[model samples]
Target: MRVEYDDVETEDDLRVTYQGDLFTGEVVERSPQGQVIAITTYFNGMEDGLSTEFYPSGERKAEGSARYGTAVGVHQEWHRNGNLAARLEFDDQGKLLSRHRWAEDGTPIESFVAES
Candidate 1:
């Protein structure tokens, strides 16, 4: 999950530098004005890697990881104020194993997976 490079076009018709990390290939979908609209990444065609999505204003929308194409790792989503909206977990096959959600003030609203 390393970002080789991005093919984003700048206002001057130049290629913008795409900065990426090793664990996940941080990809940013930009608008026509070179503003980051969405950020997404993948592993094996599914969201089984790392992804950090942002709002139009460059605020983090969601962030998480996956295994074998399943959400099987630490997943954290944030509100506009950067408060964790939800914390979730999954299995290797993308089955929901557990989840813990919160409001803007951090009230623990919880859930779990009951699969054999």
Candidate 2:
């Protein structure tokens, strides 16, 4: 699979296509003023992966992956100023697998698994 982005931002999605076949990706979200708000992705035309990023103010807000049209994998949450608030990981079945507090920056603090 291959992916590309002309000017992928908080308002637009990062599309992924395989061999000219539309595989998956997120959708573009725009502000009422016509700028951008967040981009939520879909799977085969379903609410699967979603990445709710913030505007130009510097806030991560929310960004992550999903499976079978559900939230899964690594999920990032942040403050309004583009700061990382939390870093959480989930299982394939939408189960909370791990979590970690955000660091001073928006980067993932650390990886810690949850008890099964």
Candidate 3:
């Protein structure tokens, strides 16, 4: 079920309750002009699955996945002009695996891989 961000009550941390019950589904946050600014997925009141944030102009700003509130897999961010800004990888257990970043002009800024 999808719900407006204002309609949900935030509990501790990433937990949210909708209509007095733990929310399990998508919560959408909108700009004042009604443009979708963010979409977050929840499971049993905790952040899980994919969550995405968008620029006011509707370009994707960032995207990532989580399992029971712990970030996992690849998370990415982009500049408003459509260039990749950052990329991070995490193991299934939420351990950081790698990180890369680029400037808005697409120049490499940083790159690091966790030592095995």
User: What is candidate 3's lDDT per residue for 47-98, written digit by digit as tens?
Assistant: 9999999998999999999999899999999999999999999999999999
- CA lDDT scores, all candidates in order: 0.61, 0.62, 0.97
lDDT at residue 34 of model 3 (Cα atoms) = 96
lDDT of 2 at 79: 70
Better of 2 and 3 by TM-score: 3
Query: RMSD of model 2, in Å?
Result: 8.2
Between which residue pairs do clashes occur in model 3?
none
**lDDT at 116 for candidate 2?**
68
TM-score preference between candidates 1 and 3, better one: 3
For candidate 2, the per-residue lDDT at 91 reads 81
TM-score on alpha carbons, each prediction: 0.61, 0.57, 0.97
lDDT, candidate 1, 1-116, per-residue tens = 34332542222322223332123344556756677766556433333457677766788888777653456667888888888898887666767777878888877776666667
| Candidate of highest lDDT | 3
RMSD to the hidden true structure, all candidates:
8.0, 8.2, 0.9
Q: Give the CA lDDT, 0 to 100, for residue 96 in model 1.
A: 74
Give per-residue CA lDDT, model 2, range 1-116, as digits (tens): 11323233322244343344445565555556655567756565345655666665434567887765567888877776556778788888888888887665666667678786
